[model samples]
Target: MKRRDLVIAALIVGGLVLASAVAVARLAGDPVGLLTRDAAASAGLPPYTGVISTFTVMVWFAAGTLSAFIAWTDGKHRRRLAPFAYLLLALAADDALLLHESVGPRLGIHELLIYAVYGLGALRIAYLMLGEERIVALAFWTGAALLAISVLVDVAFLGAYLLEDGAKLLGVLVWSTVPLLAHSAPRAAVPVLGLDRALEHRSQPG
Candidate 1:
């Protein structure tokens, strides 16, 4: 990475640590808790209990990172991939924090409302992918379909935790393939300004 990129990354990490300390202090009056214990220990639960959720969060984060990398490196496709980067990152944060299920409820924001917002975000992504390669778009659509089904099962099947979570996990896995597919697909030729003029000059019996 460039020195500037490294510096920016360091600043971001530092800011995150500072913000987290402040938040912890405000909420629990003990910033030490943020550093001293793992989440499972703090919750009095076995570490394995959160394994699946942790995996899901990791996948979401990985997808976001991949999308961001593509956006940064491929100027031609940056506009299309940038939104995916942001949305995937937001999803990762929401999942990691249980924002929709727990925090949103406490804040009087209905879980359904949060789901609707996410649904619209997914639709926006689908629309953006309309001009992409068919295979890549198809994978994303399949992932979205699986996620929709997971949401449906969550609302209707109530107690079918295994099925709902399984579908959701599969959806995330499929969705995460989009960045990889995009990165591997042949890039279109980028137009170079004045190239034609230069070629014409060279061709003119020089």
Candidate 2:
């Protein structure tokens, strides 16, 4: 990954966070009484009683977009395809989120797939980052722990979807990892043109 790639990753994660904030806000400010009940039908759990204002939605959505971007772009460090694929997968869920308010359970499958991919991608990134010996510090350890916890949180959502409606709100926990992932390891530089090694090294910048 190049420095520019890292910057882009940060931007993507920021976008996810932003998106999530917007989602929660809309749920709260459902002008026409869309959210008749604060409780999630699948999870059987109540929604947050706190005011879900547009400002909250804006902030959460931005963060969600940012995190979703990071999870989607999972392989920028080595294999670009991995990240690109994940981003596309996340989009399915993002779109599902847009219509879930009116669709009523029809889009749960899409949302579920998104959460699964997001969790797995997050786990992969944490594995890579934690492999670095230098990441044994307090901050790094905290981040890694959070990533691990996110996997469980995602799993909880899966369980809720499959069994009860009590845990549908689990996504918030996993998406929170976006900010942590934004602080990434130093990326490898994209070497300039070097004809001598062009044929020998495929990854070398042409």
Candidate 3:
């Protein structure tokens, strides 16, 4: 395997191990819980909230890395994709910086504005993807829908931090898979399981 693949594997494995450890800590109510509680106290948030936020950061980092790799490899040939790459980077930055949660409130801006910016970015990416890879387009739409639901959950409810974060992570995972899926199938650029492919195969000669 390539060095990049090795690094990615390590990151995934490490993240899994860390998540397991956190789970164990929650069950045991020992040092891990104590540490997490202390950290939460310092941060003035719930313990699980800190844990969820940490995992969310990991997801964002992984997404950003994948996006950067896609931009580096594919953007060389398709210059228009450079903007998509930058969009992913901006997403990572927004998550890392908590731009909406932090800066938005300070500037008298609502989270809706942040969502609008993200919506515009997604729309631009969809426009760029027009007539290109249909699977990627579907992935983008699916991710957008998932993220929209996450935003709604956050806005409409209270004390659902874990649920909100889980939804956001799921959405990010969907988005992260798009570039990988597009690269995985060179001929069709999608998993060979959809009705479109089924119709095409059905129409083929025996």
Candidate 4:
């Protein structure tokens, strides 16, 4: 790896370690228990209980990592892929932390409001992905449709864990393919708002 990449990785690891130490100190908990233990172990539940959720979180994280790597290296589509990376990372954090289910409710934020924010973020991603490769866009939309079905089941049925989580898992699986598809596709020039034109005008001799 390049020196710059190694430095970036070290900084990120250091920041995470520092943050975890601070959290453990303030929370008055064992660092391992608080930071390293699985949710099932912490809650005294069977390991299998969180297996699927853990898998889903891993998939989201992997996709986010891939998207961030692509965005960092691919300047031609950085504007589009950077936001996509951020969205994926946020989604992974939300799912892994149960922010919507536990943290949001405890903070007096409505679940629907949290979902609305996520929906808006997803819409923004869709808008950004516009004019990209058709196959990549199609995969994203398919994943989105599956997620929509999952959300619908969550809101309407509430008891259908199999259907809700099944759709969600399928959606995550489909969504994880986006970065790979995008990486393999040929880069296309995407226009930014008047920036190119402004640069062109500035280049002309007075």
Return the top candidate by lDDT: 1
Q: How would you encode candidate 3's per-residue C-alpha lDDT over 122-198 as one tens digit per residue?
A: 88766555434567767867887887777888789867876787788888878777667655636644432343345
Worst 10 residues of 2 by lDDT: 161-170
TM-score of each: 0.81, 0.31, 0.62, 0.80
At residue 67, candidate 3 shows an lDDT of: 63
The local distance difference test score of each candidate is 0.81, 0.43, 0.69, 0.80
For residues 1-206, write the lDDT of model 4, one tens digit per residue: 78799899989999998787778767785655456667678888987996877888898889888889888987745666788888888889998988988999999998789889989988977766664567777788899999889888988898898888889889989988887787787655332332434544553599
Model 1, span 84-150: residue lDDT tens: 8898899899988889989999999999999999999988878767656666778888989998998
Q: Judged by lDDT against the true structure, how good is candidate 1?
A: 0.81
Ranking of all candidate structures by their lDDT, best first: 1, 4, 3, 2
Cα error, residue 35 of model 3, in Å, equals 18
Clashes of 3: 0
lDDT for position 12 in model 4: 99
